[model samples]
Every structure is written in structure tokens, then in C-alpha cells.
Target: MIRTLAFLVLLAGPAMAQDPAEAAQTAAARLDSAATMLAEARSGEARVDALTETVRAYEDGLSALRQGLRQAAIRQRQIELDFDARSGEVSRLLGVLSTLSAAPTPLLMLHPSGATGTARSGMILSDVTPALQAEAEELRARLEELALLQSLQENAAETLEEGLAGAQEARAALSEAIGERTDLPRRFVEDRVSMAALVASSDTLQGFASGLAMTVAADGEAPPPDASAFRGELPLPVDGTILRRYGETDAAGIERPGWVLATRPRALVTAPAAATIRYTGPLLDYGNVVIVEPAPDTLFVFAGLSETYGRAGEVVPQGAPLGLMGGETGEVQAILSESAEGVDAPRSETLYVEVREGQDTADPASWFSAEMRSTQ
Candidate 1:
């Protein structure tokens, strides 16, 4: 019995220090917060902003759920491996305990070495029984935890589905609100005919931008607020990874004076600082584009959006929604399965950012804060 228990203890290995339950609780809290935000978005006065926030909350919640599920899967696998390795030993230990329990008391008391041997055996059994009990309790706890983690993953599927739906709904509402919105202060009205002519005449983005800079407001609207103070302190317009730096050559051997960011499908793009919309429409080879001027002779150009928001010459506040990247959001099952298999959801859309000061194109990396870059 002593040998069997010792063997079992050796096979049990080290206890898992990290708690999956805590991770599950944290994920649950994030999901709850997302749900609350979704509810508020439905009735919020600033529907566009509220819905944008709601979509962000859902994205966060879904990310947390994926992480939590991954951790739980890892913990579950470890526990299962431990149990599989110790199964034979545990069964033998149980058999020995059962035999001892069923044996006659007189037979148990009797020993070849008489009372002294019996007393020693009793003392050893007393110690061994508690250790065995402790081992059993630990195994039971592990089994319980495994069941809980499994249940958590199972329930997470539904939660993930709900979160995906909520995010889609919010994004749709935000887009609709943007289309209907007309209250933004306009600095000037763009001349569509002149802009079209400029677009046709200009061969390079620089030429187009230079022509745009020369445009004057017929209504004499005040210039956009000075953004020089916020230089090197602005947040990124979108959450993404820097795919290519300014002037980086691509596979086609083409070098562009802009940063290309890899972002998830439908990721929100916002204004990095208070800026006037210089242009918002398709231009040249770039898809839908948004050009905003934050200060005199300074332009921030965002390209490759699936949709553009606001309008030309409108002053948008910092963090205002500018647009969304294109691509379909991943299905909940696909996301969960990928998470369980330790695969990260891919960033399927790209956004191009360019900072132009006067006629010179500056590196966007120098304009954004280090902390903001680090997160990307």
C-alpha cells in the first residue's frame, strides 16, 4: 500500500499553479461589459459614437474569450495527460485500499511478528491512509476543474456568437448614423467638378495633395484647430500591426512613402487628432480614401478603406470614426476552434497612412506616440 501510494504521488507530478477559473471570470466580466455597452448603444443619444464604442467592447470581449479558452484548453490537456499517465497506478492503489477495507478485523490485527508488528503496521497505515486520502482529494479537485473548464469552453461558443452578432449590429448602426449625420461643422464645400478635374490632371499623390492644399474656402471658414502641440502624442487611427514602414519596398519593388497597417476585418478607423476633412472619396489607385488636415499645410492621408465617413471640409473631433476596413469577420466556431488550436485570428485588411507637411512627406512613425506604436 505504501509503495503504491508513493508511486502514485511520483506520477502525479507538480500541481498547476495557474488558475483557469480566474481567467474565465475575467472573460465573463468583459463579455458582460460588452453586453451592457450594446444595450446602451441601442438608446444612446450619440448613436454613432456609442455604437463605435459598443463594437470595440465586443471586440475586446471576444478577444478575452479566445485567450481564456486557449488557456483553459492548455490546462485541461495538462490535467488529462497527468491522469492518463497515473491511471494504472491509481487503479492498483484503489484495489489495495478496497482489499484492506474488506479484510476481517481479526486478520488485520494478526501479524507474523505478533503485536509489535501489528502496532507498527497500524501506525504506517495510519500515515499512509491520510496521504492516500490527500491524493484522492487532489485528483478529485483536478477532475472537477477539468469539467469546469470544459463547460466554460462549451458555453463560450454561445457567448462568442452573441458578441460577433452584437459587433456586427453596432457597426451597421454606426455606418447608418454616419450617413444620416449632417450636424458636423464644415470648413468649406468641395467643388466636385474642380476636384474631378484635379484628380484627372494629377499623376502623383503629391500633385493631387498640393492642388488640394491650394483650395480656398469660399465661405471663409476658420482653419482647423492647431495640432502641433499633439505631435508625437497622437494615437494611431486604427488598431493594427505595422506591416511596412515609410518608404519600404514591396514585392513589386515599389517603394511608398507611407506606413501600411495590417488590421482585422471591419476594424474601426478613427481620427487620430482634431482635423478638417480635406477629402473623402476614391482617388487614383487607392480605394476609398480620407484626407484630413490637422494644421496649416499638414495633411494626414488614410487609404484602402471599404467605406468613408464624414465629408470634405468638415472638422471632425479627435477619435471620431473615419471609416472601417473591409473583410468578413470570422465566424464564432472558426474563431473558437482556432483559439483552441493556438492559432491567432488573422488581420485580413490593410490601411495605408501618410503624413504630408507642405510638399514633404514625413514618416508616420515619428508622428505617433511610442506607446501607441507598441500596442500595434
Candidate 2:
């Protein structure tokens, strides 16, 4: 029975020694795919679309990597705790095995009882041996897994650095493409003088929006596309968590009629629907803002961007890049540490979304899809 147990242990050891870096490997594969996309974007005819996809790929790959690292850290901690809890039992088991291995075959076969008693001892050994072997195999597997998690963390630094660089490049390319883009339809020519005067006169977002609603399009210009069909189905313009719901008071104890989203640094912001850019620039207390008229008498206001894109009066398609959120991306070490600590990616920027119909503000939550909000 002892010999059989030892043989089983040997067999299980080799099989259980397989790498436990499956999560890390999957994340690395995603990063590699993103790199391939980046290469294709360089020469793609539709640079804007290509670069946009590339950026999303990088974001997904990095998110996967962070999650994998977090899981690994958790698994490693669990294994360590298990080992600590069973250290005494493991030591005693090892000592017993060592003594048995050193004993002569004749002595090992001899029991302190007669033949009938020896048979009973053999019966007990038969049941206990398999359980001991299984325990040994589990311990070995956990040890191997712990080692692998450490190795993955050490090697992931380079992969993360490269992914971050590629994402930055993709974003820069997308920005340049949008700036050079002239194919989008025009609804009107923005009167800079009028816009400037409105900005100077308006002290609140509602006031500004109301002023914008009164601006007329140039004669013969096309009307803004109808986005009413997309009501209750439009996706949020950016990937993020809803930090503050409509009418929720912020840290400053002031309430707003909009949804504030918390997003990662430099995350992409896109148009939720096909719309004409009514305004795109800094406004009072809001950073860079983009106000798009998605339908007649309806406007979607996006505020708090680091950099805005598209000229006012240009009609852009849905999912068109609007701007980027502010703040610098975290370094590899900081990201790894945060992952190891099992925390979410830092959302260092905020985007405020407001829906205005004529002069009254409507809840953005009603306009955006419920599923989209839950997922984000």
C-alpha cells in the first residue's frame, strides 16, 4: 500500500506541475492582438476607424491583464494561507514518510501485533494511503501555482509598458485623423461672435444651453439628423461608471441635472449618436465641452474633456471620437501594485452628460440604455 501511494504521488506531481499562468497568458495574447491592430492602423485607409479600434483593443487587453494579475495575487495569498494552516501536519507527514523510506523491507513488513492484527492494520493503511497521496498532490500543485504567480508578475511589467505606449500612440493618431477629417457633413457655419457673446453672458450651463437653442442655422444648410429613434437605446459616449446620477449632489454640495461618469485617464469619448456639433470648446467651470444637436430641439452636452475634437457645425456620425478625458495613465509598477491589491483601475477623470430639450433639462439616464449603464 505504501509503495502504491508513493507511485501515485510521483505520477500526480508531474501532472499537477503544469503552469497555472492561464490568466496571464490570455491577457498577453490580447496585448499581442492589440499590437497587430496598431500595425494595421498605420496604413489603413480609414485611419480614424482603425485607430479607434486599436485604442479599444489596447484598453481591453490592459484591463484583462490587470484582472488576471489581481486574480493571481488573490490565488497566491490563498495558497499561502492554506500552507500556513497545514504546516504542522505537513511536517509530521513528511517525517513519517522519511522514517518509512529509511526502514528495511523486513522491519517495515513486521507489525507489533500478530497475523490477524497485521491484516487489520493493512486494511486501515489501504484507506489512509490514497487520502495522504491526494493531500500531497494538492500541496504540490499549490506550491507550483504560487511560484507561477510570482513569475507572471515579474514578467508582466514589460508587456504592460508596451501596451500603454501603443494605446497612447493610437489615441494620438485618432486625434490627428479627426483634425484632418473634412468628410463630415456641415449643418451650418458657427457664428464665432455670437458664440463668444453667449459665453460671456451665460453664467450657468442651463443658461448657455438655452442661448445655444436660439441660434439659427445658415440659409440652405442641412438640418440636424433625427436621433429620436435612438431614444432609450443610445449608449453612453464613453466607457465609465456613473459617479453621480441625475440630481445627485456632488462633493461641493451642489446638485446638477446630469449624469457624471468616472473614467480612466485619457479614455476615448465618442458621439452617442449622429449629431451636428453646435459647440466644442471650454465653458464656465467646465473643461473642454462638446454640445451636439442630435435631433431638432434636442441637444446632448458633453463636458470635462482634456482635449475636444471636431469643428462646431460639422455633423459627425455615431461613435465618432469627440475628445479624451484628462489625467496621465498610471505607470507599470503602480498598476501592478493596484492589481495585486485587488482594486479597480483608477478613474481619475469625470465627464458630465446633460440632455436638453428646448430650454428644459431631461435625465440622461432615460436617454441611455439601461444595460449599457449596468455594464459600464
Candidate 3:
């Protein structure tokens, strides 16, 4: 999260120059910048870089759009409250106008009572009439301002809807670009026969992880990254709220010692650091899982992904596109089904992550950076 914030601060230079109300324009400008870079890029590597930047732009644009909408909603609510508070005053003024319109001259000059009423009428006109006119004008001005603000809010909302659609399209384009890149180094590719034998022999996830660790140990390749360096500084694969924390018990009487993040549909998943893809397949109860070996004797297991990208042996750099969360017809239903909320209730798609030391599960909250955990 710290790294991402730094990246945003560096990239949002031009966008920050504009007023908050011009969020849509700022977002459009960012997209234009990304598109220009993509057009100029020639090689596959360059295109990948361009596409990644383009995704960042889309992310920024989405953030800006959400902020604009929230502020607009607040303003709209304030306007409604103001209008409601003045309703009685407005009605009373209308009543006065109605009475004066019927017989203005006769009512002012000769009252039903007598000449004393004429003097009272003159005093009221001299002192109170001007104040009433001023108040009416002030109300009219506020109404005009409220109408303009509403129009702007509506326009911003329409733009936000259009921007959301464009963001989805951009994400698809990014995935395609990432899939085409094939220069990443491979650690080791396991033969299907051996992998199947291992899977069939293993009774549990711990057993499978142990088997895979032994296989990689035999290969004699150096460990990927230092595990302690990332003890409390690792970033999540995707932006989401941690729906289920480590050591939490579920309705089924099973305790899950990992995090289940609730992310928006089709959110991109990325690598936290350079690591070898240890295992990429389904395990018992867990959906599609991607085990990453960042260091010797340490493994990062990610579960609940809809699609697996890159080969099992590929070593991906930090922040490289790994895969995506389910859209509408994949792991979302499976995860939601396990919830006590029931199948018919609204539920978000989730990504489960577990960091393992050989076979034992580690507390992920302590592993993640303080900033990252706070946001979650």
C-alpha cells in the first residue's frame, strides 16, 4: 500500500492541478496520456509496460469518479435539507402574495375595521415590505444555485457510469496484453504425470505443500526473495476489504487461518514480489489455488482465483499481472455459498491468502504492513 501510494503521488502530478470538481476531466486526461504511450510502444515488453500504466490510469479515474459522486451526494443532501427547512417560510410568503394579488389597492387603503388600519398598513409597507422583498430574492437565488448544482451532479453521475464501462474495457485490454508477453523466466516446469502422482498421493494441503517443497529443493535453485524483509510489508494481490481474517471460525465449525478479501468483480490480481509459481490447481474445499515460493522453506498460497495465468514454473516480478477475480459466473458463487448469508443474499467475490512456513500457517495480519492492514 505504501508503494502504491507513492506511485499514485508520482503519477497524479498533472491531475492534481485541476480542481476537485473537474475530476472527470482529470481522469480523461490520464487516460489520454496512457493511450498516447500505448500508441508509441513497439515491443511486447514496452506494450506490457504501457498496458500496466493504462490500468493505473483507469484505477485513478475510478477513484476520482467515486470521490466526485460522494461529494455531489453530500451537496445534494444539504440542498434538500435547506429547502425543507424553508418550506414553512416559503408557504407563508406565498399566502401573503395571494392575498395582496386579489385586491391590492382596496385592502391597503381601506380596511374592514376603520382609519386606524390605514396607518398600520403604511407602517407595515415602510418597514417590513422591503425586508420581505429581500428575503424573497435571497430564496430565489438559493433555488437557482441549487438547480445548477443538481444539474452538475447529474452530469457527473452520467460521466461516472460511462467511465466505469470504459474501465472494464480497459481491464480486458490489459489482460490480453499481459497474456501476450512471454519473456518471463521459468523456474521449473513439472511433468503432468509427476504432478498427478503427487496430487493423488497427497492427503491434505500441508502434505501437497511438503511434496512440492521437496521437489523444488531437489532442483537446487536459489530461493527467490528474503522472507523476513517482507514480514510486515507485503501488499495484497488486489484492492479489497478483508472479509474473513486469520484464526476466524466459520459456521461450519472450521477455523480458517487466512484472509478472505472481498473485491469488486473482475479485479486484477498481482504478485507481491518475484516468486516461483509452486502450484496452480484446485485443492480439497479450496477452489483454484496458486502457491508461490518466494524463499526457501516459505510459501505463499493464494486461493479462490477464477483463472490461473503464466506457467507453474514462471517467476513473476512484483506487481506483475497474475490473474483476475471472477466476473459473474465463477468462484463468487462458490465462496458466497459458504457464507451464513445464504445463497439468495448479496455477497461479494473473495480471494483467500495463506502464508505457510513449510507446513504451518502463519498469521497474515502480522505479515502484512501496518498501513495495508489499517486500510483493510
Candidate 4:
């Protein structure tokens, strides 16, 4: 904010612009307040919030300082903008202090809380310390190790007991790092962070490009589920034969509760249910797909498509000719988000059927009757 006016002064005439060293000194004072706020937090929530915001403030202040310094150097035709701490002023000019003014990139490095920030009760915020942070880093490293193990499944490995020992260690570290006193709640955090991290993994980056694709927007009152009047056994969105049954599978094989087709010709698909479209675009390799809210907590995803008929935050219904079914290469394969195994964070399409009353998952398969079977 201060930089705006200072730049204006520079435009007017020489000797008008504020000294860059003075600007840095002024910005540092504000950064000290942010740091103090972060350190003196009472609640874990306050601490985390303060810490996050402090990091941003430091970054923004640093950026403003660097810009000011660079401009001073340019105006004076000097190689470097030197600051004299003893004199408390800008003196010699040498070169840009780019590295000294660098700020760390903000990443969601901490585990996901799964608090949803919507839970009204039984929520525990994280109390982070240097020790806790080290543990968190260790746990994250172990998770990466676990992913590698999953990839190299067929090789000679330690016994299951050994694996359990490692897992327990990781769980303990994570719990301490996040201040999660309960196993169940901690597991939720672990799962969410792990999944998100997977989508962001370099080798797993394609997973984002694959699976049932959808873009999750900011929190809002999600539109009600659109009844999928067009849903049936017959596959139009996906064209192919049954390659794998829905059940347990061999090592490294994709085993989903829902059936998997061989492959289909990618084409324009439609919204299978009546509801607002959450996302309509190419996710991963699910090609282009559509995500619709069919009912409360029920998400219907149509993947391996060619084009989309709608966009994110739009309303659509079943049998709506979404778009052309065929894509650039014309290959189609859709996975139901009904099963967690089918969900790929970047491309994952697993459904979330919140336990409303007496049922869990609501058995989407049951929704498809014998007649529905005849169509796909």
C-alpha cells in the first residue's frame, strides 16, 4: 500500500521517491508484528491462522521491498542497491539482493484436518511446534515410501509385521504432529492429505489426468442431486466390453467395486442425473467428463467423454446431450465414483454417499435395475 504512493512520487521528479532501504525497514516493522502474533497465539486455531497469514504478510512485504530496491538501483544507474544498517539509510549501490529477499512458497504441507471448517463440534485444531513439524515431515516421507512400496509390490519384501511396525510409527508421528488424540479422526486427516498429495505427486500427476475428472470449486451450498433419468446398463458415454469384474483384484491391478469396461470411443456425453453440474471438462484420462449433484451427498460423474454440454456451477438434467461423445483419439472408459478405489484425487471419481439414515453408500448398483442393465 505504501509502495503505491512512493512510486507515484518517483514518477513526479528525482529525489521524490522514497528510499528503498527505508521502505524495507518500515516493512520489517510490520513483519515483526505478524511474527509476534503467530508466536503468542492462545488456541491452536489461532496459532495456525496467525502463522499462515504471517507467512503471507512477510512474503508480500518482501516483494514490495525488492521491487523498491530494484527501482532505486535502476534510477541511480548503480549495479547494486546497498543498505547501511549503521547509518539506517541506502548508500552504496552494487546489485540486487534477490536471494536475501526471497520468500518461501506457501504450500499445504501440513496434513489435512478434515475438519471441513464446517464441523460444529468435536474439532481439535493443530498445535504446531518445531518438534511436531519434524514429525510431520517424517510422516510425509514415510507415506512417500509407502507409495513406492505399493509400486514395487511383487519384489521380495519384509513380513507384514514389519510393515505394521512402520505404519504404526508413521501413525504415531502424524498424530503427535497434528495433535490428533483419536485414531479415527487422525485417520481422516491422513487419508485426505495422502490423497491430495498423491494427485500432486510427479509420477502420479497423470492420475490427475486420468480417473473420473471433476473440478471441486470453493465451498457453497451444493445444488441438490439431479436424478439420473438417463442412467442404464447400456453404455453410450463409454463404449467397450467388460474387461474386469467389480471385486478384489490381483497385485497392482485396478479393483473397483464398480465394473470396468475394456475401453470406449470417447464422445460427447450428457449429465446422467438431474442436478447442478459441479464440473464439466477434461479431468485426467477419464477424458472429458461431467460431475452432477444428484442428491444430498450423492455425486454422479460421467467420464471418458469427448466434450461437455455445460460448465462448472451450471444446472443440467439426465439425458441432456452433454456434448459430442468422441474425443481427439476416440477412446472411452468411465468409472463410477461409487467406490473409493475408483477415486483418483487428480482424476479420482469416488462417490461420497454420506450415511444419512440407516444406509451407507446407498448401493448405486441397486439403483440400476434389470432394465437398466439391458441398456448399458
Candidate 5:
């Protein structure tokens, strides 16, 4: 009876019998095996219900593991600081002994007599004749070292205390949070919980805010810049064949209005008319492109090129090579003109004149001079 009682006491444990992580892992594996016992059953109520509960339990266990891990880290840091404080004290005590021996000054020792004897008044002396002096020197050196060590210990103790307090505060907060989360739906478990999720939520909110800022907001239709003040008609930016006709059909076979296609294959693309470059870079879907401004309220687009020669607001002359044709997938797009207010109308680069329905996209066939179209 005594043996059984003792066995029960041992099993109950003063140490609380915490499972080694490995043992907990093994238990998890066992539960996983149980959960999969009837995975083949398509509509068994018992199997489906058991599997769902198992999944929820697994997720809960994962969240608990993460919390436990953070607590473990706090404990480890506390232990490390405690060990370092003890070791530092020991080192300082040892260093004090070394410092006292290095000097022969007797006045600094607590017992000057011991220090005096270690160093004889005689001009020449053997090492053993000055035992008192050595003792006093050793003691003083040890005390000095101890003093520094105490300073360090004092600072370290304060720092350690602060760290521990902060850690405890954080741990308490997490403990309260965990307790509160017990009522949280299973959706709160696993990757759905913790700092990473908070960070992700913050990032998502930031992006949403940015997108909201980008959305156009206004009271009415947009205003158009005055185009009638322009001095003369602008020349076409490129000298190339119209690989695809304007507004008739697109490369995707979709009928789009007010855009023209010209493919030079590998021909040089240049600025048309004397104009300031609006943008000298690739455009979405159009590949490498250049946008130039020849007059107030008018934009010239030269797209599908391998190179660009100017920057925004830099003046470009007509026939100046902006870049070589990119002509990727055998299609090149150029706009002789465009309006800042249009939905899809393009600025032209293929003709001197274009047909527009009071919009930027114009009929290239009407705008192209008969003489220019033959070669362009």
C-alpha cells in the first residue's frame, strides 16, 4: 500500500509533469492518425464531424504552441542575464587581485603595515622578504576589482530587472489576451492569430487607403485644355508603315476606336514635330514608348520602341530618333495625339491630321494625307 501511494505521489509530481515538446509532438501525431482513420468515407457523419473537430484542435494547438514559445524565450533571456551577472562578479573579483599585485604603493592598502613588509626598505631583496607587502597589494587590487564589479553588477541588476519587468508585463498582456481568446471562434486559431496576422492586416489597410486615395473624385465632367492656340500642324513622330490600320481592328481582334497601329519592325522611332517629351519610357501593353508634347493641350505618343532619347519636358525635334522599334509580337502602336480627358482616344503619331468626335482618338484614315499613307 505504501509503495502504491509513493508511486501515485511520484506520478502526481512536484514538478507538474510537463510534457517534453517531443512527447507532445508524438501525441499530436497520434491524434493526426486518429483523425485520418476514416478519410475515405464520403458522407459518414461521424467521420466528417470528427475530422472537422480534429482540424480545429490542431489549429488551436498551433496557436498555443506559438504563445508558449514566446514565453519560453522570455525565460531563456532571464536565465542568461542571471548567469552573466554571476559570472561577471566572479571575473571582477579575480581582476582585483591582479591589479593590487602590479603596484608597490603601500599607502593605498587598508593595512599599510602588510604592504610595507612585502616591499623592504633595503635596496636589494628576495621575493619572500616582502610577504606583507604582497598581501596588502593583493588585497587592494582585489578590492579595486571588486568595486568595478559591484558597479557592473549594480547596472546589470537594474537592466535585468527592467527587462524582466517589461517581459513580465508583456507576458501578462499575452496571458490576458490568450484568456480572452478562449471565447474566440476557432477561426482565431493558427496562422490567423499572432503578430504576423496583425502585420498583414496593417499592410492590407495601408494598401486599401492608398487605393482610395488614387481613385478619381470630382463633381462634374473634366475640363479640356485649349487646343486652338497652337501655331501649326505637327509632323508625324515616326516614318513607318501602318502595320495595323487605325480603329478598324486591333491585334486582339477587338474593335477599338481612335487608335492607329504602325510597325517598323526594327526601324528607328523619332520625335514627331518640335515638342517637349512628356514621357520617355515604356507604357503598359504598348512596350517601349515615348510621349512628347508638341503644343499646349496636345500629347504625341510614339510607342513600341527599343530605345528612348529624351526625358519629360525636354524639347525634341521632328525626325529626331527617340528609339529603335521594339515591335514585340509583331505589333507596334503609335498615337499622333491624345486628350488628357478621354477614355480611350489616342494622340496621333501616324498622320498630320486626324478625325475626332470632339475626343482624342481620331480616325487615322481620314487624317493621313494620301501621299503620306502610301509609304507610312
Candidate 6:
């Protein structure tokens, strides 16, 4: 955990652009806080809770590292501009020093005319030299800063690779812990043949959603958990920043009415609240979509997952492992803030979440915790 924290701190160094040095220091302090929890967890007491917290810490740290890397690239360009601006000052300082060094001390003392002239010349040089020296020191400081910035960028890049690997390992451990437990009562079992036919006939997501709702109701199974109790209090399925919020327009010129979360590659996903899996499979352009119902008139749609768990009939408690994002390196090249065009490299993995009440779209932001809402 300490190793993970260290790499994260290195990656966070560049983001505090106002004070990169201070940012690094702050990151270290934050890591210390995380480390304290890890040490307490090592006592073997509350192993499950400890492991879960550990995974969350690593996930948070990995997110910080990614943000730092993006800032580092911008800082590098700023440093180049600063170096260019200081070049003339550095050259002038060097010229002044070269001129002073050419003459011997004895010659400077005994000027061409007399002692009076020598004294006057000495006074002028003494006064001018200090100013020149000050300029030189300022230039040197900027040069040092440039070097430090370069080092920070290099270290962040290397640490990012290591952090991704460590984070993924921790995610796998958490997944196993979550998958082992499934105590939610089963409500209904989906018939594959019927579901396939319903899916084939439905022309839109809304149509499919409406049909699924009616099917669950007809089964006369016990109602799923009352997720309304968690309105604005539920946690996200994965630890990440909301890249795009409900009703936000993306660069593709399409307005999205769901929450889009940018997560690490292969990151484990969980059920935000207790729900029965209504449907789980590929849909249109959504990649792999999972529809879960936590209560009557409340259906949660999770899309863009690469691997899914549980069939259409299983009930999962809040926080149960659901699926994972795709990709090997866990690195994304573009975000919702940027256009996908010209991005030949693999983009970041995203999870699209839509909360629905009947046929109307509900704002997902109102379904998450207060702390998470602040992040959005």
C-alpha cells in the first residue's frame, strides 16, 4: 500500500500547477493518511473491511495519478516557454562575467589614467556586478525549475504504469471478496427464449425497458429492494470521476441523458443498490448493457461493460460485483471532454449509467451520494 501511495504522490506532483513542489508535499501527506489506515488493517482484524478500504485507496490514488499526468504535459509546454524567455537574460549575464574575467586584478586596480579613475571604475563595476549576479541567480533558478519539472513528468509516467498494474491487482482481490457473497433473495427467473424474442421485437431501449417492467410485474415475485430510500445517497458502481453528467452533450453531437463514468481499465463494477438483474447482454451501440431493477418503476441501466456477472434472474445486494471494464493497459486516450476523432490510440474505458422511472429518464446525479455529487 505504501508503494502504491508513493507512486501516486509522484504522479500527483504536476497537477498542483500553482505550486508543483507544494502539490508533491500535499500528496505525501494524503498518502500518509492512507498509510495509517493500511497499517491498522494489517493487524488482521476486520480483514474484509480492511481489504475493501485498501482497494478504494488504491483506486483513488490511481485516479489522482491520471490527472497529474495530464497536467504534466501542459506544464512541460509552459516550462519550454519560460526557458525561451530567460535565454536572453542568461546570455547577457554570461557576457558580463566574460568581460570582467579578461582583465587582471592588478590592471583593474591601476587603471589607464590614475588612482582616482581606478576608484571610480571599481565603484561602478561593484554596483553593476551585483545586479548582474542577481540576474544570473534568477536565471539559474528558472533552469533548475525546468529540470525539476522534466524529472517530475518522467517519474509520473513511469509510476503511472506501475500504479495501473497494482490497482488492477487490488481490484481483482476486491472482486473475489464481493463475488463470494450473494444474499439478496431471488424474485424471478428470466426465460431465455422469451427474453430473446422480446429483445428482437423491441426497436428502442425505451420499448425494451417498458416490456421488461411489465414482464417482472406479471411474474408476481416479491418487489425488489426499495432503492428510493437511497435517493442521493447511493454510491457509484465504480470509483471514478463523472466525465459527463446526465443531459450533457458529448462531442459526437449527441446529447446524453445518462451519467458517464471514466474508470480504470478492467476495473471491477458493483451494484449501486440491491436489485434483480432484469437483462444483461449486448445492445445497439451500448456495448454490453445490464438492466437491473431495485424497485417497482425504478430500473438502473449500466452500459459499456466488457464482462458481466449473473444472469437476468439473479438478485444482487448493494455493492455486489457486476462486471468489469475492457482493455489491458487500463489507459484511455480520450475523454468526453475531447473528440474521439483522430484518436487512433485506445480510449479510456467508460461506464454509462441511466436511472429510469417508467418511460421517463431520471437524473442519475440525484441517485448518488452527496460526496459523489460534489465531485461531479
Q: Which structure among the candidates has the greatest TM-score? A: 2
CA error at residue 285 for candidate 4, angstroms:
5.4
Residue 237 of model 4 has an lDDT of: 28
Best by lDDT: 2
TM per candidate = 0.82, 0.85, 0.71, 0.29, 0.29, 0.67
* Model 2 C-alpha lDDT per residue in residues 1-376, reported as the tens digit of each score: 1122122222222222223233234434544554566566654335676567666656655665666666666766777887899899989877766786798877755678878777787788788778877877877777776777677677667777877887798788888888787666788877778888899898998899888745544632666698898798998888888889989999999999999999889988988888998899999998899999899989999999999989888887787788999999999999989977878688889999999998899999778973562212
What is candidate 1's lDDT per residue for 1-376, written digit by digit as tens? 1122122222222322233333334434554554566566643325666566656655554554555566566677888888899999778777877888899989977879988999998898888889888877887788888777666667666666666777787788888888887667777887777788887898888999999854544543656667888888888898888889999999999899999999889888988888998888888999899999988889999999998888887888887889989999888788878867767778889999999998999998778863572212
Per-candidate clash tally: 0, 0, 0, 39, 19, 1
TM-score of structure candidate 2: 0.85
lDDT of each: 0.74, 0.75, 0.64, 0.36, 0.37, 0.65
> By how many angstroms RMSD does model 1 differ from the true structure?
7.9
Higher-scoring candidate on lDDT, 1 or 2:
2
Q: Model 4, 81-198: lDDT tens per residue? A: 2212322322111111232135343323323555454242223323323444464455455445434323222121121223223323422332232242111111011133333543
Candidate 3 versus the native: TM-score? 0.71
Error of 3 at 61 (Å): 2.7
Off by over 4 Å in 5: 1-235, 327-359, 364-370, 373-376
Superposition-based RMSD of candidate 6 using all C-alpha atoms, in angstroms: 6.1
lDDT of 5 by residue, 6-102 (tens): 2221232211124423333443554455357535534333343334333323322322222233233333344445547767655665565566567
Across 223-318, the per-residue lDDT of candidate 6 in tens digits comes to 667788878888888765688888998999788778898776676677888888888888867889888988777889999999776667677767
* Model 1: residues with Cα > 4 Å off, grouped in runs: 1-45, 90-112, 214-217, 220-223, 373-376
* lDDT for each residue of candidate 3 in 207-285, tens digit (9 for 90 to 100): 8888884454234243455556776777777767777788887678777878878876666677776788888777767
Of 3 and 4, the candidate ahead on lDDT is 3
